[model samples]
Target: MSLLERLNSDMKQAMKNKEKDKLTTIRMVKASLQNEAIKLGTKELSEETELTILSREVKQRKESLHEFDKAGRQDLVDKLRAELAIVELYLPKQLSEEELSEIVKETISEVGAKSKADMGKVMAAIMPKVKGKADGSLVNKFVQQHLS
Candidate 1:
């Protein structure tokens, strides 16, 4: 089933179970997806597009979590943590550091990236391969380590 189908199924379950937080998150995600499809003038989104939107949602929550952590807002931080957890449930399984390292090494060799100067080239080549599976910052860290 597609992401939308999964979300709809889960949404109905959440409503029946009285899971307010989960139901809200599901609705928000569904709305964003529909909005994106409208914005792009499409009837539906491709899996790639869906993954891209989901990744953006995850990234946004992470950024917010970081900010709340620094501000020492425990209440907000806890809420964001919960929301982040729910959002992450839809993302692809994350890549381990070792696995990411291997890909970075392979990509570096393939692109013939000699040093930091080729950071852009390495990132452009690898991001598509990794996409939502790996965090961009983690990928950048690996690329920097391998290149330098």
Candidate 2:
């Protein structure tokens, strides 16, 4: 089934099961997806676009978690962690670090990226291949390490 359908089903299930946290997170995701659709003047988004939106939500949650951790707000951090877990359930299985590293290495060579100056070129070529499978920051770190 499509991501939207799956989300709708899960939302209903969450409501029935009284899973407040999961329900809230799913609602937030649905709202985000709907907003993006409205902004683009479309009724629906493609699977790839949906994945991108989900990834963005996960990234935002992780950043917030980091800030909360730094502030020693355990309650907020725990909440964000739970939300992040729910959001991640919809994402594709993430690539292992070693797998991501290999892909970055291959892309660097494919693009003949030798110096830091070529980071952009290498990233542009590699991101499409990795997309939802790997975090962009992690891929970037690998690229930087390999290039330097």
Candidate 3:
């Protein structure tokens, strides 16, 4: 099934199982997806668009989790961690550092990137290949290390 369909099915299961936290997270994802669709004046969203939205949601949760961790709020951190886990269920399998490094090396060569000056070209070439599979900050780090 498509990601959206799977999400909808899970949402129904959450409701049936009285899983309040899971239900809330799924509803938030659905709302984000619907908002994006409305913004584009379309009822159907492509899988790529859905993945982008899900990644954004996961990023937000991770940021919040970091803040909560710094503040020593274990309760909030735990909740956000659980939410993050739920959001991640829809994302593609994340790339390991070695895998990401390999891709970055290939992209740099493909773009003929030399030195930090060519970071933009290399990044543009790599983003499409890595999107939804790796985090932007992680990719940026790899690009910077390889280019510099």
Q: Backbone collision count in every prediction?
A: 0, 0, 0
| lDDT for each residue of candidate 1 in 5-75, tens digit (9 for 90 to 100) | 99999999999999999999999899989999999999989999999999999899899999999999999
Candidate 2 per-residue C-alpha lDDT over 1-148 given as tens digits, one digit per residue, 9 for 90 to 100: 9888889999999999999999999999999999999999999899889989999999999999999999999999999999999999999999999899889889988999899999999999999898788888998899999999
For model 2, what is the error of residue 92's alpha carbon versus the real structure, in angstroms, after optimal superposition?
0.7
Model 1: pairs clashing at backbone N, Cα or C within 3 Å? none
Q: Candidate order by TM-score, highest to lowest?
A: 1, 2, 3
Residue pairs in clash, model 3: none
lDDT of 3 by residue, 1-148 (tens): 8877888999999999999999999999989999999999998999889889999999999999999999999999999998999999889999999999999999999999889999999989999898899999999999999987
Return the lDDT, model 1, position 46.
Answer: 96
| Per-model TM against the reference | 0.98, 0.97, 0.96
Better by TM-score, candidate 2 or 1? 1
Error of 2 at 127 (Å): 1.0
For candidate 1, what is the total of clashing residue pairs? 0
Give the C-alpha lDDT of model 1.
0.94
